[model samples]
Target: MRHQEGLALVAAAATGIQVGAAMVATRFVVHDIGPASLAFLRYAIAVLCLVPPLLMSARVRFATRDLLVVMALGIVQFGVLIALLNLSLQFILSTRAALLFATFPLMTMIIAACLGREHLTGAKVAGVALTVVGVGAALGERLVTESGTGEWLGAILVLAAALCGALCSVLYRPYLARYPTLPVGTWAMLASVVALAAPAGMEGLFTETSRLDPSGWLIVLLIGLSSGIGYVLWLWALKHTTPTRVTVFLSLSPITAALLGVALLGEPFTPGVLLGLGGVVAGLWLATRTPVASSDNDV
Candidate 1:
């Protein structure tokens, strides 16, 4: 493969790993901390990790108008989406959460169509149907075996997260076109940190400082590092590839999360899960192959 292709593949794989592990780790840390607090710490640590790079790069200036747009993106993407996703973990399994979150690509396609960036081809519609079927198959088995209100709630929150995430992806391109990716990402994260600080502060960042066990601390560190690095990789890939191509790899996230659940949490691997995984992968491939106008080339 060419160097850019190889890098895109690497970025996709890294994002898969980061998102999968982050899901599991968030569940672990949420055991000790509330979802809001955990979200705060995750971004706070990520902001700290990003600052060194931000300082080293030549500063990118933003107009007053664009500052609000970036901040809005940050609020929706990191603030609302992440907080809802973490809250969903309170009710759903990590695998189920990941599967629901995987719907973002289809959501992004729909958003693109609405924005006049792309037309929704029939293949893309079919892909979305297949993905939804797969997710239903996977979760249906679990719902039959062990049903609870919390699990359903989690699933709903994850769906909401997917919607917000799609919006963020659609909104990011204009800023990315005009500004450096790293700087744009840095500001977005910084905005998230500020937005989350108040609610997180009420929970007492210092008080929880002593509450976490050693393993919990390790999980937090991994979440922080993965998030910081993952955003950089995602932004880099966005610079080089179409959003649909980048979104296609997101289907891999649930598979990774399922495997992690089996390895880390001893969750049983069922045939239904396998079938669902296959469906998700196949659907994403079909969706990505369906031509949509490139975001970069759109009006």
Candidate 2:
């Protein structure tokens, strides 16, 4: 049991890091593609990637109601969340977007608490608070460096995106507990693809995709592949751990974006980021010190 929970935590952490990397990649290609178009294509590719595993897994029938619920979640999560984030990138730096999106854990904790699905503890509250502060510290330098009339809009969009993800994360618990991760994730993502289709068409996804340079195509492919793998890891982790435990790992996203910026975009590494890194690490340790069982009945 301990080993499984440990692996779940690792999976959650890896998913967070993957999402951060994808954010950078999305920022690179978003200008060339409309938000709806990019989201459609990204998840379309991700669905293709997930289809193989879903076929190989033992099939289980979903109740009609559950199917609808899961599909709605998929639309909100991959569809709405990615669309909002992509739109936000037009107005903010990837690091700034990542910083704001890092609020996902706090949002998840709050929603889960309100839903009576999870209890709040001092350690959990402090850990969530510290990680938020840490993320702000890590990306605070860039907040001033990148500003525009749309910056506030970008922040709002990112927050909305984070809220979508948080709600999905919390709501997914019962379904995840009831179903296999691969099928649930794959089906949910497929639903998002269908949901995005009309919007993608309106945005000229077909034309935009043809115009992409090889480098841009490469980035999109990477984002899709990572997203497919990340979704599975995320669902699997959530199936094995509490939502707070899973979402708190998202604190790594902004840090990953910040460090990647230094390496790839030639951005400077500052002392504040270093201090933020420490806080994130310490918070993770404190938040995850006591492992909660994965059962949905726990409250």
Q: Which numbered prediction scores highest in lDDT against the true structure?
A: 2
Query: Across residues 72-121, which tens digit of lDDT does each residue of candidate 2 receive?
Result: 99999999999999999998777778888988999998999899888888
**What number of backbone clashes does candidate 2 have, counting pairs of residues 3 or more apart or in separate chains?**
0
- Residue 238 error, candidate 2, Å: 0.7
What TM-score would each prediction reach against the true structure? Answer: 0.87, 0.96
lDDT of predicted model 1: 0.75
Q: In terms of TM-score, which candidate is strongest?
A: 2
Off by over 4 Å in 1: 1-10, 132-140, 207-210, 290-296
Q: What's the residue-level lDDT of 241 in candidate 1? A: 54
